[model samples]
Target chain A: MSEEKKRKKILEVKDLDITFETTAGNVHAIRGVNIDLYQGETVAIVGESGSGKSVTMRAAMGILAKNAVVNKGEIIYRYCDNIGGIDYNPEYDENAVWKEADILKMDKKWIRKHINGRRIAMVFQDPMTSLDPTMTIGKQIMEGMIWHYKIDKQDAYNRAVGLLKEVGIEDAEKRMKQYPHQLSGGMRQRVVIAIALSCNPDLLICDEPTTALDVNIQAKILELIKKVQKERDIAVIYITHDLGVVAKVADYVNVMYAGKIVEVGNINEIFYDPRHPYTWGLLSAMPDLGTDDERLYTIPGSPPNLLHEKEGDAFAPRNAYALEIDDKLDPPMFEITDTHSAATWLLDPRAPKVEMPKELKLRIERMKKEAQANGSEL
Target chain B: MAANYNAEPLLEVKGLKQYFTVSKTFMVKAVDDVSFKVYPGETYGLVGESGSGKSTIGRSIIRLYDPTAGTITFNGMDISGKMSRQTQKDLRVMMQMVFQDPMASLNPRKKIKDIIGEALDIHNVCKSAAERDEKVEAILTKVGLAKEHADRYPHQFSGGQRQRVGIARALILNPKLIIADECISALDVSIQAQVVNLMKDIQEELGTAYLFIAHDLSMVKYISDRIGVLHLGHLLETGTTDEIFNNPVHPYTKSLLSAIPIPNPELEKNRIALNYDYKTSGIDYTKGTEHLIDGTHYVKCTDEEYAKWTK
Candidate 1:
């Protein structure tokens, strides 16, 4: 914990706002989003579709759609020359210099040259669509390294082979000659990870990377990513709707609702002592194996349409415990602990206290008890 | 769940095999000798990973794919063979299916009313257009959708609403069995609960049985009375939900159950999935005969293997 505090903050997103100007209307996609990532921590941004989880990450990647307009805020990224990887450049800086750049303000050329693949890399959701069908997997993994690092072909080939091995692909030499179509979905995703790792990125942005694979394969992929992240000491920002994925991978959780972050906390706080009603709904909605309840707890309504500006909180209409003030004015982030806060009127000092569902409370207790019985820390 | 055991099954699949001919020289055996039964008012979950042929079995039972071998008996009548006109009409009213992708399965160009009322139109069940609209609206309302939504296209509604439309379409005929193939896989967590609750409510009120096919073990356990674990086109085990979950005999079933990510962070972090590789396991699935664990549980295995697994 002490060393973790000493680690540098690699990325910070402050008051990020984005909008999509469609033919019908202007859709305010992202609204005042804030996130912080240390050198090697995992922060998960979770929400339903159209809640702007992907848009926040896309903005960080500087790969937002052409129609998207970043009206406000900035993504500050800092990387040092000592960012250790196989492709480390010895000629750069003698003592290693820390560099900072606003991704929003940086030039496209500069981003493509330094930030895109060198410092930050992304593994998209669909491996099939992301990988080139025309090229062999080996050449595809080697292309970025050779182009970006100005390395020799033979050196890139050996590095690519080693990467494929690191991602758990066997018979690396034989598999390298295969095309994307010939490989299975799990193998293809592994190859995609290999390509992402080829750049030796300090920050890995995985946008629902394992959603396309099966459950067994998803577990393996998650493990592989965690292993790689630990080894590389890289910060990861995982964007997903699956609570299971988030619970398994995240060090901290960001609960997004209608383009705004409603809750932020560490894994234990978010899972065990969630303050926001949305987080409670999401956690309870997931069907655990040991639950005996006939009916699951569900959020009452859908997310609000982003095109139409609402009066106050976007989730107010759906929250059963919503206060009158929630409709009149948006609630600011209420600090629960040093690392935990919730943006909901329910967390207000003046508002009436409302607990999560009775059944859900029992379930969480059961989970904690079971965890203790299993000799695991909660 | 055992109450339905004494009653005859509504849908019975026996030695079902569905194969696809990739070329003249090679064929893909998607569903090989898979068998199970769905009794009235009880859900039978078919759980399997990708390429496990769970979807293939659903498609074959719905008669979307011609089975390569075996028989499908629906309500004690063989529907696997070439159908007569009356049998064909009976099949339409007796069994319906809700697909995975609501938007793609539903016709985009068609209005919500027409989409739900298509079965009625096919069978000429309604007396007039008003009667059809009334039936559509009633079913739509039953699925928790508004009557006003019937006029809009499938593209107009959100994902959960469209799935409600899909359920409405399948329920318009009031079929005895509804084959929901990964129906809630694409939905958000909160919406998933809503849909699951809605399905459970419909089942309670209408007494309709469901053949729920999905890879999500937690959801399958939640909704299913009985579960059949499929792996690589074979039915590895069949048992009551408790038996399959708590006393899984097959290594494949154990691996699948262990793969499910519990939502609790502490437990999830400590989860070490039991990995099962068929190539290295050295167990021949083809040589296995069905072995009984109990009245409600069965695992396919050779006698020698069965003795080891059961012990």
Candidate 2:
């Protein structure tokens, strides 16, 4: 089904490595990571805190901290340089091509003027912190357009009200004049989404956008994002640790563990037929509504310390089915299908085959049965 | 299991009301005429949204914020208002609380030993310094921490470890009831499970009752024997875990249950969210009353709606 849709690669990251120089020691925040984001699709990065999910997205957006260092990587973003009547359709003719810039190599001024908030936008976790309390909501929403596109004040103002209405905010004109504190938590988030969407960016990076909202409000926000994505054909990268949220929104899933993507697959593959042990632990650890078990199946140990250099697989100590190779060497990404891969020694053909835990298997079966009863596809 | 009818509840809250004066003209009814009972060796989960006043009810029960009206009966003694010094001191040892934020709850300047030991010292539970140290060490170990951790500051520990310290301080009092207010909301999934398992184990070992206050429905269903659904500072529904989850009668309860995001992708896709509108529903809570549906299920509704709902 995914192959049938024509997808344009909007962003690509190859071998991205990030480190932080802390007083205690240097923290290896991001390992040799890679990701491919296409147009009009949602990809979720799931992990616990300190798993470097936020750091990776921050590096992509050129918003890393001062103490952070990009050891080696290339973040290539593709955008059509419409000036001077340049041909943009490269697929039809070899001469027609778009401009590509490596974000890491580009100067800060160039990126800020051309790329950041123009072709890509970010929505932070806390709307209160992201939205300026001093400025009116309308002015904050219009600031991006006026600065980036050099639009007139009246045009920006008209579009800002439209954007607020599009985000499902009632009384858009009245709310535009209100400050951030005057709005409720859900309304503040809606305003944040409106500001992020004002620029009409190609990709919207939402970093735990709904973590601060209540469940009903969270559902509304997720639905709003999905609706906006469909209407505008914008690719979304959601960084969150909640599996339930991931299952609802994502088409693809990346399970990160200790600064590395341990597994990458479609949502169905990750939830129903998970290959990595850490993914299994995450799924089992969540207490579902129907779960009646005495105790949740935890991942045994806490996340590994990133201050020290990691040896072999970072999750080897916590993996219950770890093989001898997991302790000696880091495992390569073993392909399960064209769209699914897992970094685990157990995926090696020479290693003995092991099944997922019985509890998880039973749960998957129950989920499948429930889905069938509801006439939904898994 | 059925509730013990003859035995007195460990904690009984009757017509509890906590109001805050937001302005000179307006008073915010944080907890408005709510009532529940926490039996000995049972977990009573209180689930609601952020402004629904679940935390306010907890604070009122623990007397952190004195209630504006109604009585709180602990071990058959009415300890609501204007208690004697000895009664207040005795009530302190019988009831304790675990706050939500571990970092903010624990004093950064004090060592874990002193933080937990202060409770013992205030209550004069220990005879000497050695006995206090021994008790602190024992409680720390009981919460899955090493005795050596007692010497470290709160900043040195992780989020889960700091929550363990909070639990240790609450357990050191050897209270009959502990009100855990969103204690596991800040931790990760794996660590949350560990902490929850620890709570269950402690409850089993000590047979202590708990007023588990949180917004997460699945966790509440897992830990609670009976649950009370609160909305706008009112107790809308109260029932056993099974009765509340499987046979929700109140429209508010149904809406809350439907809003919970289950983990299964396919199931969640098929899930239809029920939005409850109080304005359009035309339900006046002031005139509404609690209606018993079954043996252990109760729903708040008007007389006409109660007949329809029960029917």
Candidate 3:
């Protein structure tokens, strides 16, 4: 039995619509998307390329490209009463009042002063590209704290060294003096995580943080992020397409497709009992070990091109279980459980039931049996 | 299921050592004293982390970079020494390569047809332009692309489609062995599955042996018949897919396998990666002999190291 923990809404994006002006045409990147991030829980956004996963997070961070236009939507960020949201739990204070702010309406100057680095921090996919080549590792980590809190040079230096040690880097003093190029890929990513945690942000946005690293390093980085989240009780938004990474990091799963949240569910619900056909395709397609099947299942067609004018369901062309109604209208998000929901025509009460791929079903059952044997949660 | 033992090996590397001289006194031993046999129509996966020299082994086999030492034999011919013009020409037809990044590998300036058919022009295999177009279109359709797509440039297609073009480029030569260096690593999971399925379909149709060099363990295990685990430029372990996954011996090999991210949240949460530090393990590759365990499973270790690891 799990304890009833009070979950507070931290970041809310309602009906987000973003378009980019290109030479070919106006690409409607984010089309009427909605995402809800709660306090102290990791939420993962999974999708194929050009599926608007990064664009949604970029919108939340106020880092959208100049050529992009936000046609509609609102992003609400709630500032908790306690610093770092440490005392927002009911045990500390039953009345945890949150002061809400509309992130979209805020000007760049105001946002930079309050929200950008102090309350929220982001780690990019590639650490090499994100870090300044000319700047030393220590300066990059210290700059955020110095700029946000206006701390003294000595204080910032001391904090940077501490953060480096916290991220599991050895010889922090020597590493702080070296540049990004001097460090390995895994070490550089550790430095990036150190910088992100330097400002003590409550919400950490990691967009494929370990995608550019090797597999062994990836496991360590994922562990490090989880360690920090537990220690500080920070809410993490993990943006990645790797299902394994999602299973390792996320508490909630948001499956995005064609700029929309096609499926939102708890990690178990999404992995074990997925309803959407697109979700089924993604789950079945990953090449797993010890499988006898010669052919891996693939989504029948590519994602819909956003440059062209769309019709009913953008996924209708690729869905194997697409109903005639899908051609005429977009499917609404049908609720499966309190924490599980999927956008698909097959979820309609009148529609014929469709089963997930046999291989995926068997795989889930096998995984559940394994977990049960291991005495872990199933 | 694996390389046919009765059949002759398609490619063999004996004591392969590929070292890069950084300075007059310093050298980077990218691939150090590694040897493996890839039989006909089998997929031999070379897996390692960055600087583990999986790609170096592939490059040396393809003659992209001349190996600093060792012998590389292809189809019963020793291709390690200076290649005669006839031998080079023959090798071109028997071997081809697929690079990691489709964007960087393909000629962005040229049309898909030209990019895929460049081998035709180089080898003078096609009689006329119409014939070249026909060959290119056939390969395109084989990889799940249309004839009209041959007219577009690399930028015109999506990441998956561009990768198809890369596969089409390799297929146009009708090569016996294709060294796919992280071919599906850059694509999304769905698209990666599609590309991998395409590769499998092609392999079934042509019976081509693939030297698949990648870091993704799951995918490597899925597609490869036999796997060679590389670490710090040495082949620490080599075995069939089942042997490598079910019963890994070396501590480094075991560590690599443990680091694979499980897709089930329940199981993944219970997982902890086993750590193996070479400096602390007291295992030196420079002083070891490869010992065969059984059924195509081999581990490069000394007598004491083997005894310790097996126990």
Q: What proportion of the real contacts between chains A and B does each prediction keep?
A: 0.72, 0.61, 0.78
TM of each candidate vs. truth: 0.97, 0.96, 0.96
Q: Model 1: number of clashes?
A: 0
Clashes of each: 0, 0, 0
DockQ of candidate 1 is 0.74
True contact recovery of candidate 2: 0.61
On residues B19-92, what C-alpha lDDT tens digit does candidate 2 reach at each position? Answer: 99999999999888888888988999999889999998888777778889999999877888988887788788
lDDT for position A371 in model 2: 80
A347 Cα displacement, candidate 1 (Å): 2.6
Which portions of model 3 miss their true places by more than 4 Å?
Answer: A1-4, A80-98, B1-3
**Regions of candidate 2 where Cα sits further than 4 Å from its true position:** A1-4, A82-97, B1-6
Interface RMSD of 3: 1.1
Better of 1 and 3 by DockQ: 3
Displacement of residue B101 (Cα, Å) in model 2 is 0.9
Task: Score candidate 1 by TM-score against the native.
Answer: 0.97
lDDT of each: 0.89, 0.88, 0.89
Q: Which stretches of model 1 miss by more than 4 angstroms? A: A1-5, A81-86, A89-94, B1-3
